[model samples]
Target chain A: MRRVVITGQGTINALGRNVAETLQAMRDGRCGIGDLEFQDVERLSIRIGAQIKGYEPEDSFNRQQIALYDRFTQFTLLAAREAIGQSGLSFSGELATRSGVILGTSGGGMNTLDENYRSVYADGKNRVHPFVVPKLMNNAAASHVSMEWNLKGPSFTVASACASSNHAMGQAMQMIRTGMADVMITGGSEAMLCFGGIKAWEGLRVMSKDACRPFSANRNGMVQGEGAAVFVFEDYERARTRGADILAEVVGFSMTSDAADIVMPSKQGASRAIAGAMQDARLNPEDVAYVNAHGTGTTANDKTECAAVADAFGHHADDLMISSTKSMHGHLIGGTGAVELLACIMALREGVIAPTIGYEEPDPECALDVVPNVARDVKVNAVLSNAFAFGGLNAVLALRAA
Target chain B: MSDSIKDRVIAILAEQAMLEPGDVSMDQSLEDLGIDSLGLVESIFAIEEAFDVSVPFNANDPTEGDFDISSVKAIIEAVTGLVATQAA
Candidate 1:
């Protein structure tokens, strides 16, 4: 079995445009959630989100490419470019045949769907653009990455709602570890900040009208966000032999389903996944330092996740630092875990723990140190990133310092 | 109190609570009717549609919202007020 390591990483989110900028913002505890700007936003009761403002498609892609690529695909490509460039491994010959790509996305081309729906239904147009199907498909981002990088091996997209990225990355790690592939270009992307996207989510009544204040007693609900984060996962020996900069080690991943309610989370299910990930990594609870929580700021999620963490770590839960970066970047849905994974890597490499910002009133249920409202400087050996999505799907990933 | 509004509210609550309209009483609270958070939200939406008046509600803190769900009568009063205001 081959050991997997993350050789390169890239991201573009509400907080920043690239890895450096994003990490710096995390260190600064900056909040990217604010007033959402999109069509029919004024009509929505919840009119705020962590949208990537001032982004122009024309600047990154030609007219034809823009027409063919959806916003989510574009974001994935941009992050993939940075990640693959950082890895410095060209895809050709045997390497290309042995490498692959897998990306995660919930609303694959929501913007494209929203536009075409409007064209046919609202605007009374008879036909939509010819590329609409290809642009809006769920596998578009993964397919584009495979084509762009010439990854001739396995390629697909995973969609498990919010846990899509973690599942996708976990699959990539398994592929490399089992000698299924030499390298896997993997991560997640989401651009669902469009009118139809927000409007659909608004019906759920789980969105905050203002900020995402995870773990705060005053927290109302989750704020939506949009972005992408991509990474290169290669065999550890291969990366070391090539002198590639290893970001973090792909250690362990565990996924669980509650088999309970669809929208509600189960503490037992989450705790199982948390404990299972640690068991898989052969890491004791004390060995872990920080946990990037799936704190969605919702009345149910924040408390439920806190309870799960406490149950999994037992007494050590009191000593460990757990923070939700979603408080800063907002919940990116399927793309969230990948962006949140950046915080885990930062804790391992930079010794900086991202804070759970917007903390005000203390939540007795979430009594653990949330590292509230201010970044902390701490060297950590192992960290866990948790992603629990709707439908009771839970995926927990463990990483060690490289 | 408008009789039609009361009847319509009771019908909506009954539908959501999965009970007979006759079983719902003005003294009964949403909890008494077995209306959970999701059911309460759906009831609110139904009430707003029935009267064609927007109900200012945020499920984050149901108590903080202007709409009152303390009891059936309280909800009727809030809806009546909203309906009158919209008519004005």
Candidate 2:
């Protein structure tokens, strides 16, 4: 199998619009959750969310493109544009055909669906918007990204709830490793901050009323967020020959199914994913310096994930610096894994572990270090990002310094 | 009839449609308040349930102008009229 390495990374979240701004916010331990001002809701206890501010479609796409794309698709396009731009990879001729795009999203175009539903059901309107179908589809984000960059190989979207992006990136890595594609643009995007979207999540009753406080004793639940993060992955030899700036090497990736409860997390499933990823990377637990946990600030998730880490790493679990960037960015749901993967890459490259902000009082059940509320300078040779989604899906990716 | 009722109605309207209370006035058309046709329908539905009154709409006419259903006061008036008519 060919070796895959990350050449570029891009992200747009509540923290910032690009990778640098986001990384700075993470290092500074800024919590992006606040009173959601996007839509008015009646006495909603769940008022805080990590909403992307100051985003305009005109800044990223043309008028025609904007008409066909939903907010999630627009976000994916923006992140992909930044990743491509940073990679300096020209999508021309054979390269375009040899490249692919894979994206992940759970609640795709929910805002569009909510608006149109209101228009049709409540207003008794027969006419729907011309772009509603294209805007509401799950594949729309990947389709938009592919069309924007003219990628022809193996383009599709993965929907594994929160693990969506990890599944997408893992598949993209497999494609490159198996020589199916020389390069792939892969990531996830989520824009479920609309009125109806929040209402739907409110029914789940797992969202926090305040800021996300992962691993904290006072943690209530996950705070919903919206954003997109994408990475440009290419074969190491091709990247080196092209003099591409290697961000990090995709050392390992593993996916597992708990086959257990739908909403309740499984420690065994998460442990298997971590063990499998470590095996795939040919690295022992001692080699890992940091772990970007799938800590969603929920009581069940933090405890279960900490147990999984302990099961996978044994004594090394205490030594490894574990943190959840979700504490600052809120939970991006589908896009979270990709964004957290970028955190891992940044940690491995910059030798700085981003903190799990909002962690005040640690829960005894979740006794990991969690790098609470403050960024730490560490020599990270290898970093692991874990993403556990609903429906028993779990994905883990290991990244090494290039 | 009371200030509290008015405030509650206004708060619900603002929350449901993401509008400011100031945007909804006594004489302004609901449509003009950025309450789309669906929003108008939902608001009417919510108001009817809230006040326990039936709001009559001409089934044949479904336009923004048709929904002259203006302010909270106008809504209360329509509901009261509908209730009186039903009683008669």
Candidate 3:
């Protein structure tokens, strides 16, 4: 099987608008969760989220584009542009035909849905926009990315709740490994901080009002976050021949189903996925030095994830470092795993592990070394990114330095 | 009016707890009634819709929220207070 490697990455998240700015924020250990700024935010019981602060669509796209693209699609296109631009590849002939796009998102055009619903139900409008259905479809972002980049190969979107991004990226990697595509522009995006979005999630009661303190005894719950992250996954040999700047190698990926609970997590399922990724990558437990945890700061997720890690790695669990960048970026839901993979890439290439910021107190249940409150500078050869969704869907990816 | 409010609160709690209103006890805590955290939130929503009064409850830190949800009796009293304040 051919190897897959990441050639370029870009993101517009709560942490930053691009790869450099985001890595810098991680290094500084900044808190991006704050009072959300959007229409009807005052009406929400939970008033804070890690929202993109000063983005203006007019500055990035034309008026026609803005009318057709939802907030999630806009974010995806922006990140995709940056990633493809950085990769320095212009698609024209067979290269274009041999490339595709796969993205993950739970709320495809939530902003459009919320607005149209408001206009019809709240404002009593007789007619809605004709583009509403096209804009609001779940595969809109993936289709748009493929169209923009001229990719004709396998193109689709994956929506497995919180594990969406990881599942999408894993599929992208497999496509390149099996020679289905030489390159794939893959990642995830989410724009669910609107009134309807927050209202729907509020019903779940798994959100924090103040902060996301993952693994902290004083932690309340996960905070909702919005934005997107995109990457260019290319064949390793192709990237090497073209002298592309390889960021990290996609060494392994594995996904599993709990078949246990719909909303609650299962440790056995999570551990098996983790173990399965390492086995696929042909890496020993000792080879992994860091883990980007799926720590959502909820009362149920943190301890359960720690137990899963313990079961997966046995004695090596205590030696490796695991931290949740979600504490800083908040939980981006479907797009979260994509952004957290940046942390894994950073740890492998830059040797700076992002901290689980807002970590106030430690819990014995989560006894691992959760590089708390501050970023750690340590060299790491390999790392794992874990994403466990609400429906007991778990996906883990193993990465190594390029 | 207060009696009506109490009856509505009891009905909502009973619905969330999956018990008949006759089977519910005023002194029983939400947990004792087998209403988990999500059920408690749903009960709060029912109360708000029935009375058109917002309950200042944040599920992240339920105990610290201003809305009292300790027991059926306590929830009824809190909803009554919110209704009165909104009316005023």
Candidate 4:
């Protein structure tokens, strides 16, 4: 199998708009969870979320494009443009046909659904926008990215709840490893921080209204975050031949299912995915220096994930550095794993560990040394990114320094 | 009115458990009613919306929560007190 590597990365989330700004925000341990600005905010029992501030879509897209693009699609395209721009790849004939786009987004066009539903239910509108169907489809973002880049290869979206992005990237890696695609624009996006989105999640009662403090004993619950992170994955040999600046090497990936419960996380399932990722990479437990923990701040996820890490790494778990960037950026749902993967790249390339910010009191069940509140400056060679979704679907990706 | 509150709570729990009100015993634990964690959380949301009073139950550590869920009777008592406090 051929090696796959990340050539470029870009993101627009609660923390920052792009990779540089996001890396700086992570290094500074900034909290992006705050008051959400949208229609009918008071109706939601869970009011606050990690909504992107100062985002003016009109500045990026024109009137026609805005009407055709939903918020999720817009986020994906914007992040994709940034990633493609950084990669300096101009897709044309064979290259364009060989490359593809795969983005993960749970609520593909949630805002569109909210607005169209409001029009009929609340405003009593007889007719809705004709482009509503095109605007709201799950594959809209992937299609747009493929069209914009002129990619004729496999392009689709992955919807696996919170693990969507990791699943998408994993598939893209396989496509490249097997010579199915020379380059793939893969990542995830979400724009579910709307009234309907929060209202639906509020019913589950897993949301925290105030803060997102992962692994903290007094942590109320996970706060919803929305945004997108796109990365350009290319064949390692091709990237090296082209003299491209490699971000990090995608060494291994593994996905597992719990088959136990729907919402409740399984320690054994998560452990299997974690251990499987290292085995796929052909790396020993000690070789992994850092882990971008899934750490959703919910009680079930935090405790179960900690136990899984213990089971996976055994004694190595004690000294291993793990932090959930969700503490700062909040949980991005389907797109979360993609954004968290940025932390892995940063750790492996920059030798700086993003802290699990907003940490206070630690629980005995979560005994791992959670890098709390402050980013650590240390040399790290390899990193692991973990994504455990609601339905016990766990996906882990292992990366090495470029 | 207190009996009505208890009945409404029972009805919500019943709806979640997919059982009849007669089948749901106030003395039975949530587990005995076949209400798992998700069911319990949904029941809390339904109760909150029905009464317009926020329940202090935490999904993370239910033991530390001020609202009790030991049994149907306990949930009823907790909801009744919360409703009473809201009314006052």
- Pairs of residues at least 3 apart in sequence or in different chains that clash in candidate 1: none
User: Judged by lDDT against the true structure, how good is candidate 2?
Assistant: 0.85
* Candidate 4: residue pairs that collide: none
Angstrom error of the Cα, residue B42, model 3: value is 2.2
| Predicted candidate 4 versus true structure: per-residue lDDT over A151-177, tens digit per residue | 999999999999999999999999999
Models 1 onward score TM values of: 0.98, 0.82, 0.94, 0.97
Proportion of native contacts present in model 4? 0.59
RMSD of each: 1.2, 12.9, 2.2, 1.6
In order of lDDT, best first, we have 1, 3, 4, 2
Q: Flag regions of model 1 displaced more than 4 Å.
A: none
**Mind giving the per-residue lDDT tens digits that candidate 2 earns over A171-231?**
9999999999999999999999887888767545567776788898888778888999999
Q: Whose TM-score is greatest here? A: 1
Model 3 misses residue A255 by how many Å?
Answer: 1.3
lDDT of 4 at A235: 98
TM-score ranking of the models = 1, 4, 3, 2
Fraction of true contacts kept, per model? 0.45, 0.00, 0.41, 0.59
lDDT of 3 at A320: 89
lDDT of 1 by residue, A1-402 (tens): 788999999999999999999999999999998888988778878888899999999999999989989999999999999999999989999999999998889999999999899989999999888999999999999999888889999999999999999999999999999999999999999999989999888777778887889999999889999999999999999999999999999899999999998888999999999999999899999999999999999889889999999999999999999999998888999999999999999999999999999999999999998999999999999999999989999999999999
Report the Cα lDDT for residue A273, model 2.
Answer: 100
